[model samples]
Target: MNSNVIPFDFDGQPVHFSLDGWLNATKIAARLGKEPTAWLRKIETLEYISFMAEALGFNSVPGTELEEIKALGTSAPGVKKRILELSKSTGMVRSRAGSSGGTWLHPKLAIVFARWLNTRFSVWCDLKIDSILHGEMSTRVQLDRACKALEDRKSQASQDGKGLSSWRWDRSSLEQSVGYWLGQVQMTLDLDAA
Candidate 1:
């Protein structure tokens, strides 16, 4: 839908709602020196919930990691119990094993939890304009620029027949350039996102 912007997509959609979006809220609170409760209104919202799912990469955390979560029969019970509760509430759990160890939530949802954990903006990024200086406006502007840069690169590559190498998230429309990718990295970082 974005004409002059690079649409962040997964599997071809027009959005990239990473877990970091919400999880990073905690960081926002930390920076604001607030109780971190005001922004919690989204705890029950789609944005918050979606962010959680995105944070947990594969949905359910690995059973192996669960044990380490709190040493099995110990203080971890509460966290484990909550995990189970959420499991029953949703089918987003993604479990794997061996080389693919560790529980993962979607990047977006994870961002919410991150706020719960850190409440620090250092985890997210602050490119083009610092969030402290520009807040949402500057960040949004930067995202727009990034998206446009990406789209322009994609169009040029397609015309150049650069071989259509896979870009982020299999986004064929994305331009191939290390700097572009680097900016993406910086963005994710600035957001203190996952």
Candidate 2:
């Protein structure tokens, strides 16, 4: 799980995306001050309502059926199974349990959830998730690459006897290296933010 996880932060809280690009819905829900199970149940309720409306016609649901649907909640019978079916069919939402467990969602549902939480948050979530899905490198990864490149440059230079002394005289080269790395970092950040 760790091998496939790509983690990022929003509003200072950590969120993760799988290598296949599934966003960790649980983390985002927590960041939004929502309970994952309750939210899922809400989603299930909406799905059930939509199905009923389509089947029975909107505003034509029988009173008893409407009441039963309204009563559907976290403890509703077969709700988990229905949710699982929904996940299997649509691939939009998923729930995992135990350690490393949380609801994971496709970017589409995640954006919807974010919108339900807050408009600004939804926009941020949309951009971030879209960036991840589009294969943009995370800022952390970009920074790491830049740092490693700089280290490699220094090490290669140090292999010669001059070492630090060489850098003192080769100030232009050093400056160029620093400028390149800084630009890389900036470009990565800008891309991720986009």
Candidate 3:
């Protein structure tokens, strides 16, 4: 496993990697030149309602929806109700109950949150997401290529009349090479192996 990558299993498919500590609100806010509190408040406002509508498959904000959303309170109870509604609709955002509790947004929603913060931050999030998505496939391809190369090297060595001890040495070398290649791949993909 690479120290730089944190693997999260999504839907029990190929492991997804998130850059270490990528979701800290403070860090995101700092990057966007906004206070975390302000950013969080913005998330709870119109932006959140917009996300809910889109998540619920509404192409456009439904009639009077914006008015209703605006009318919704921003007090704790109001926020809690909204979070519950959103959870029922998409299950993508939630509010925790407790002193340490705060609203939690899925990565996709976090990206939307970033977009709400600033256009530059939004673009950055998009690139990061794109990298994660494409990096998985690229890393797999590189690993496959490395494995094939190692196999070819071993076959060539055998064809050259390598002795048993030589074959064992080659195997050891192959293991080390493949290990190193995998480490590089993991680093490139920002992924930790499961």
Candidate 4:
């Protein structure tokens, strides 16, 4: 394995973890407190199922085909069903003949799965996913700064006789300023901005 890759145990299943992160069906099942196969069967979308299958290295389709399928989005029920059938027939979710096969999921999907299973797990996964998507900055510091900035703006608006309730900062502006700081850190470290 490359030095950049790390190993993670999702419950009892060993995962080839990357900076981008992945979750396996076994782990999701564990987290959801459901049987793995049963849980997978219950998942509504073929795209989710297929993504998990591909991430686990089970899907036989070419990478380009997979990418194209992903680009098509998950709204078409017919397409999703057809893809799901093909994936299943091709043994997409099953591991090799003799091993404990499992499905692997991207961090985003993992977060979604967690959300579906448990609110607390969802919150935890959201924080982890946020750190992965956004660079790791001290959230407390950024939050404090944002809060202070908002307060100052509110104070100024009040002094000008603008009703405090109506004097609100746009959510996007706040996000941009905080995101700007995050971008600066990323630029300094030469990290990709998510």
Write model 1 residue lDDT over 134-190, tens digit each, in one string: 334444455556667677656665765553554334364343443454465546434
Compare candidates 1 and 2 on lDDT and give the better one. Answer: 2
The local distance difference test score of each candidate is: 0.38, 0.59, 0.53, 0.52
Worst 10 residues of 3 by lDDT: 8-17
Give the top-scoring candidate (lDDT): 2
lDDT of 3 by residue, 94-153 (tens): 444543234544555567666777776567666656665555666656666778878887
Where in model 3 is the C-alpha error above 4 Å? Answer: 1-27, 30-69, 75-89, 94-107, 136-179, 182-194
Put the candidates in lDDT order, highest first: 2, 3, 4, 1
Deviation from truth (RMSD, Å), model 1: 13.5
Ranking by TM-score: 2, 3, 4, 1
TM-score of 3: 0.43
lDDT of 2 by residue, 1-194 (tens): 55456566666766677656677777767777876556555645446434544554343224554456557744788855555444334445566776557877655566666666678877877776666566445654655565666677678677876666765666566556556655664464333221
Using TM-score as the yardstick, the better of models 3 and 4 is: 3
- Write the residue-wise lDDT of candidate 4 on 1-194 in tens digits: 13223333334433332345554546456645765444433325345656665676665455565566567655645555555554555354433221333555556456666666677756755655555456554643464487677667767767865545456645457657767765654453334433
